[model samples]
Target: MKEQDTVDLFVIGGGVNGAGIARDAAGRGLSVILCEKDDLGEGTSSRSGKLVHGGLRYLEYYEFRLVREALIEREVLMNAAPHIIWPLRFVLPHSPDDRPAWLVRLGLFLYDHLGGRKKLPGTRTLDLQRAPEGAPILNKYSRAFEYSDCWVDDARLVVLNAIDAAARGATVLTRTPCISARRENGAWSVTTRNERTGETREFRAKVLVNAAGPWVNDVIQRVAGSTSSRNVRLVKGSHIVVPKFWEGANAYLVQNHDKRVIFINPYEGDKALIGTTDVAYEGEAGQVSADEAEIEYLMSAVNRYFKEKLRREDVLSAFSGVRPLFDDGQGNPSAVTRDYVFDIDENDGAPLLNVFGGKITTFRELAERGLGKLRTFFPEMGKDWTHSTPLPGGDMENADFESFQAKVKAEYPWMPRSLLQHYTRLYGTRLSRIVGEATSVDGLGRHFGGDLYEAEVRYLMDQEWATTAEDVLWRRTKHRLHLTEAQQAEFATWFSAEMREAA
Candidate 1:
């Protein structure tokens, strides 16, 4: 393995936490190398509720610190990537049969004042018959409460972090899995195998960080040949995407009979993204899927609240992700702590930091704290700086996407409105790089239906680590959802040919 590349820190996993840590550490002037077994955020990170909120439900469990940190992070993340993360209002219709009104009100009040909320609006009471937000709810619900949270393009957030890290002089390797690691002469020797070319490479690092979300134990025990007292419990959560049934951009949160709340959010432009059931999972994390019972349970919860009923046929797609929660000896999976814990083992002079649990909303703060834990080892490292910095393509002035969209429209007056909006929303300040010198649609090359064109695919390949059609279609961009099956097949054929030609 060519005498192994030496770095100050080595991170395993390409999920949000891993990417965030890489960006943070790289910005702090530390040499970093991050390797992911598959595409960035192909794991549980992309398959999240896609919200950057304080987790209102956690208030009941008295997780004051966790909630407060996450609450503050919501605005921090929003400013970091205004194009992808924006404020969203959730309407929770009051149901007397469920939790009492006073309890819900108290929870909302605490949520309002718990963290230092600056940009987002606080909760407000709503009368069902008068307010527009309550129009979609069933007649039985007479009152509701609306509160603020931020929605995120979870997959893009991870990719953007990686981009930012690489820009700050960090080495990033996707589709590369860590084969093994061993401590040697006050340092650690790690070897990774590239899945694409079947090539093995080695690295020497002073510290190793394991941010593998669902595969935390696998990396610790099998890959690193180390042991820890901490353990991770795999809890599977599933989401089903269906046709939109309500008006307005607001999302609905209904409390189920089992004391769990389900979110029905407006997704993509004309679809609804409803999720997520909590079930103890004992199988392989990669094999987790949404079962019929889970689908029925979710549909029933939505049907009980909305006037427009949803059926089995309405489900357009479904996805599942396993939460690698720190096992706190809790029997109920729902009651399990979403807070993260670090198990730093410095037995053989070198250090191994194993992150057990974390949520998408708290990844940034978790990264900052994770780096802080390693401060004693590397006192020469730079100070914290990611909270105020913008992610790749998120350099809009004042983080105002609306004004940025207007500027894009004015610049690309010849482009179609839909295409302009798509590019502006996804790329923000970086749109010019993608749409360079193109004054007409023909300049974008072949069109594959919808808003996808050859120019965009080429941009993803040249800039992003989009090696396969699925990588571009599913992760880097959600073109699969909008393209027809035949169009997708054609695009795949073209993409494969282009890759072979490049090779």
Candidate 2:
């Protein structure tokens, strides 16, 4: 074991919240280190609904503050990473059986004007019989409402934040578990073990942050050997991916018989991403998986509105995430608050900040505010600046991805449109680093089916913290969706050999 290295901040968890805070804190000139027990975003962050919108249903629960903050963050994040985070219009097919049209209209009205909405179009009424967006809907849905939100490559978002943090001089250690921590003479002495190498390291930090999402309590009690009065209620949410059934670029939201709404959004250019059941989860967060009942429930919601019915065979893949919601004593899991709570324990002159709950939309704001709570401890720390700054690969001119994409099309005219899109959308300005001087498809080295070329794989391994083939296939990129089983097996074999050679 190496000698203990001291840092200003030590963050536990590699989810969006943890990565976002690490980026924000590092940019403000704080010496920081972030450790994740598993692969980056292998936890709850990647298994999200992937929308960067204020929870519309949250409005019904009178979460105005959370909704407004999320709404404002939508545009802020959109500008920060236009490639991964872009506007998505949702068509809500009016259901007379679920809620009154007048009430729906009022909610839409508030949603249109609630937060600082710039760069995104406002909500408008849709004539289901005439509008193009309603072409795939059932005849019973005569009217619909359209509103704007943003979609994110949720896993990539976490990776980008970590990348930015690393670029700004923060140490990011993935697949490293913080085994123990103790307050020692007004500082935290933390020990972490690397799962892959079986090497343990220690760190001394002035402040410790637990953003372990679903594992928050486990870290509080088991890892740190401390307790907090605040608690996290684990609410499981799931999403199913299937081939794209509807037309146009619009997504659909339909209310289920149980009053919960399900999102059927266009995904990965050729598929639909449908989700999510809010069941109270009590098991291990890593073991949380979508059951048959949840899948059937989601399918029923989609079938009620879409003209093209979905079957079990249509489900290409399904994922589940446990929301670490702040326990507000709500009976229903869905009724639990999505708002984040910060519990700061400045006991024995050492500080430990535990984050309870947050959404993808408000992660930046949550990071900014979390840092604000620690300002008194570090009076000389830099001010909040992530709102106006661009994330890594998000420095497109004026945050215009369309124009930048057009330029990429011209530059890589020899490449397939799909491949070009894959690069630009995933890497943005950093696409050149992946492509390099490759002028043709053969220049990209081996073709592993679909758009999984050797160049991109090497770039992911060299730059991104991608070790295992599954890390690249599932989390770092969605290549698994496009590749066949045999092709995936081949890639996995090649990735294993390459990693061994590198070692």
**CA error at residue 462 for candidate 2, angstroms:** 1.6
TM-score of each: 0.98, 0.99
lDDT values of the candidates? 0.91, 0.93
Per-residue alpha-carbon lDDT of candidate 2 for residues 74-103, written as tens digits (9 for 90 to 100): 889999999899999999999999999899
Per-residue error for 370 in candidate 2, Å, reads: 0.8
Report each candidate's C-alpha RMSD, comma-separated, in the order given: 1.0, 0.9
Total clashes in model 2, counting residue pairs 3 or more apart in sequence or in different chains: 0
Q: Report RMSD for candidate 2.
A: 0.9
Residue 492's C-alpha lDDT in candidate 1? 96
